[model samples]
Target: MSEPQTASAVEEERHASWPELFFDLVVVAGAGLLAHLIEDGDGWSSLFLFAVAFGAFWMIWTCFTAYGNVRGDDARLPTFLVGMAVLSVMVAAVPGIHEGHAQAFAIAYVVGRVAAARPWHGATVVVDLPVIQAFTGVLPWIVSFWVDGDAKYLWWAAGLTIDLLQLLRAREDKLLEGAQERLDHVAERRREQLAAHEERARRDGAEAPAMSARARRRQRRIDRLEKAGRVGRQIPTSIVALRTDNVHLAERFGLFTLILLGEGLIQMLNAASGAEWDRMLVVAWAGAFALIVALWNLAVRHGSAGVALLAHGAIPVRVQWVAHLVTSLALVAVAAVLGVVLAHPARTLEEHEVLVLAGALALYLLVSATVHAVLARRGGGVEDGRRAAWLAGAGVIAPAVVIVARESLSAAAVVCVLAAAALLVSVVDRRARLRLTGARDGRAVPASTP
Candidate 1:
């Protein structure tokens, strides 16, 4: 159940607002901290903890995101802002999370999530599955505080496993009931409009469309029943409902991605500022920029297009949002890689650094490809080999580079390879677009102008 909608809440903006921007900044700050966490801890253990920790935080964010999707920016706007602020505090404590400050961090984490889970609108919104699932999952993190050492993380493992299993157990029909609330909301609006129009007609003595004799009798009976307070029913709905503004959801998700991309550039420049004026450093910096640009194109440009596909009814919102989540995690991993490379441009990365890049790109490529495939299958757009090859190639690039490149040459070598791959993807995408447009050779508008 949702609360009554306010006029201000109903009129949404075309893009993420200032509050949304602030929320994303906090989320990205936490993601950046996770990279540092991985760097500071024991190789595999810290990485595992990072994954678990990230999942917990991301799950909470996603909970709020879904809630906002249903309620829009009006009602829950303040709640979302306050929740992210608390969540930022929770994420800030991630470094000492398993150690001295574990209790403080856990409390912040729980409070933040609980804050985000509360109702956003004046309407009586029944706390739904997204929040319920997140709170249930947070129990393990909370309980972990009572225990000592590695066993705490084990509890985390158990909690998330249960949370995920429960999510899996959710009814597909209800889970996919995607647009019922939105549909009902729309129906309510239409009803209001009809009533208003009818009132205007009566006041102005303007004739409305003529009703059949049976229709007139039905209307009279309905009016009488309403006066007698006996009319009661809910709106009828079907299974294929999608009530969300797909563009708005996509736009919000894209803004969040942009937040990370901005951070990557800021961090990279900050790291490069003090480095030696050597040839390798300059080349590495360039490579880093190219990599970021390439990633931006992959994650944001096409990502918005996928949202457009959903908005246009070419694909399911569920699949697109899932793609956004996986792709977002992968983008965070890319940010982690950028942090590593930028921090030590001249030095060769360790095996773990290489693996991080590999894993992130693997997921990014796979998810990007999958979303593109989904759009392509729906005939939303034509598939190009240039984009396809790069999408398929990134996953395969990292491990091979890490293994074969020598220590002194590895860092620059990896950067160059990735830069080339990204550049080639653009070249391929450009040429294919030109051919499609029947342009023999004048400059074409670049794909994903950002």
Candidate 2:
């Protein structure tokens, strides 16, 4: 005979499990290797290399996330999928195999996603099946047959776009689920509070000996209204869950920034390997890489902190996810630019490329800082905004100065400027930390008081 269930047992089954962390190790290794390979390639080849590498990365991540969505609390399915994705990434990494082996890669990816969807069987499963079939079966077959570069790229973009949309839809579903749970909790709490109030009123009325039966009945009605009002006062738990999710997403942004920094360093090493190991080139390479890392840190620290704070308030999950996705994309683009700069510094900073690369980098920094500043301003205060604005202004101005002074300034001067920026940012970061600590400890003097 089956054991009798309790309320706690039902609740226990509803709580979601955290996704696997250690399983990402192999995927990370595969991506790093792919980045290395891309760094080794030239011109259009590099673009092709990046497309394949990033596609592979996204595929692996998407599959894992899909599995988590369907069988999050089940350890067996996720573990098996992660192992398979790791193997698929490694196989996709084979040089020259990207185009020819596209079918196999697609099959592996499709199987991973489809298998994960097994647990999600029902009405909604049908909606996802067609998209999966297009990505894994039809798109790959079509792209493989097309010998032309433009056609292949077009197909790849379309397929990847669909995959991204699916991911977004999944996130939306999670947001809705959290919202529903919060609403339910609020209603339940309100009902409990109303019940308590009604009980108190009923007791008071029954104890009054002079009260008529009609008066007692009126008191009962009043108690019911009070209970309803109490029930209505419950806090929406879904909003709270969304906020928590945002904070987690913000932290993910910080992690991605670190990944970009690593990419820059890898590119720098690749560049140095090609040139003479002279002191000047070494200094330039180190300075440039450090500057990139500093810029990344500046973007994420302020941005993520702001996101974390705003997430504590009642913001919509959709808005938060949009902001997070944009920031993540910008970070990736910046990293790609830095990789190009490091890999082909001479070619990159040349007359034709300099204008575009420098401008793009400046624009990205400005936008990133602005978004973070806006979020920060809305949450805690304007301090983060001031800091972000200053950094952005420097990012814009320094590139211009570098471009104009290219002839007049020595390589040492360029290196010096980059080094100075990094140092200045580090110092400012430390000061901010100290000030925050002082305030937390009650050791800080208020501006008005001082």
Candidate 3:
């Protein structure tokens, strides 16, 4: 049995405040607008535009999420509200990008990101701060305004790509710095132990343990390290100021997933209400609802293990950040596709529509699978590989299902197929988890167990 939680530990557990929940409303609206934009557009150009806009918007959300995770209840409500306002402007500009709103979009993105960067305003060190690195992409986005035609979008893509590259690099730097800090602390403790031994021996009139040449060199190096104050410099007050509440951070991401699902359902219902009533449309709606339920269960139930891995230093926090980012994009893409399908359930699915839906589902499963696989490899003590593999296997099947059925299936049939795949994965994953738990408890539980 686990130990009981103490009052201090209970108090330390962070939770979402009202301001943060209010901030999520902006995401709901923004997701709906972006989905509508996609549903209304055609060809590769619109897809490209969506990519750029989504990147900027995603980074903005991440900035504020990170701020809240770091600051907890102390996070400034006014700053989040301001970020929300700018994000709304950015979302509104997305639909009018070609109608002289491109500049407005660009300006809003820059301002929104800067406002989101408020949490890291006075940082003394830049090594571990991916937010600062993410800001590097803003320059190109701002510069895109002066450029003409499609060439301008290239700038936007470049900016977003730069932001991703910087995030990855900063993640590596942080991991290395963290490892070095642990090594330095170990050496410092050894040095102190040796000094204490010598002092005690002298006081007791006993001969101290003889120091080897290697030991002497180690001590000398540690002495120089102490004098140089390298360890002190490595640990800056800024890190404390930016201390993250890992569980709360995970909860925030989970909440965002729910918002995406809720928005998707809203869009589906709205489309259903607008469309003529039909059996196939109802089937499609049912499948979509089931899909949303499966996704929610998967996110809320299993996602915390990955976050715990992040908190315990088994994985870099950036890994979690990037994973969550990709998951968000995929969820939005799924929502957009579902909205289109729900709007015209009687019609045959378009090739691009099939591609988007399959790709989004596959992306979500693959990303989640990868995170869980990492957790298992890092010794989280659950046999996550089977679940990870099951999700990945289902992910792999999603695109193939589309490829084989694209010519024959109705839109509703395709959706139902995907929903069935998701549900199967969820069921199999849960059983595997239960089996693992029972085995760990020294029981031979039936595979038929829930």
Worst 10 residues of 2 by lDDT: 1-10
lDDT, candidate 1, 1-450, per-residue tens: 332321222345466656656666677677678666666664888777777677667666766665566556464567777768777776877877865665666676677667765663212222223334245777887888788877877887777676666554545445444334665566576566556645554544444445344455555655664564333243333223224556666677777677767767766776777767678777888888888887776556754522211233234554454455566666666667775676677787887777676667666676655555655665645553334445666556654565467465657667767667656665666556566565455556555543
Order of all candidates by TM-score, from best down to worst?
3, 1, 2
Q: Could you tell me the C-alpha RMSD of candidate 1 in Å?
A: 11.6
Per-candidate Cα lDDT values, in order, are 0.61, 0.49, 0.72
The TM-score between candidate 3 and the true structure equals 0.78
Q: Give each model a TM-score.
A: 0.71, 0.56, 0.78
Quality of model 2 by C-alpha lDDT: 0.49
Candidate 3 has which clashing residue pairs, if any?
Answer: none
Say which candidate scores most in TM-score. 3
Tens-place lDDT per residue, model 2, 1-450, is 111111111122232233444444444454455554444444555555455545645454534443443333554655555555655654554454445654454455545555544543221222211233223433553554444444554555566666556544655345345435545665576667666656766666677666556556756675566564433343322222111233333444455445655655665676667766566665667667667656555555544522321222234433443444444343444444444454444432444234333443565556555654775677735666756665576567876876786666544445446546545655665576677777989897444331
- Give model 2's TM-score versus the native structure: 0.56
Which portions of model 3 miss their true places by more than 4 Å? Answer: 1-11, 119-129, 171-241, 304-314, 375-382
Worst window of 10 by summed lDDT in candidate 1: 305-314
The lDDT, on a scale of 0 to 1, for candidate 3 is: 0.72
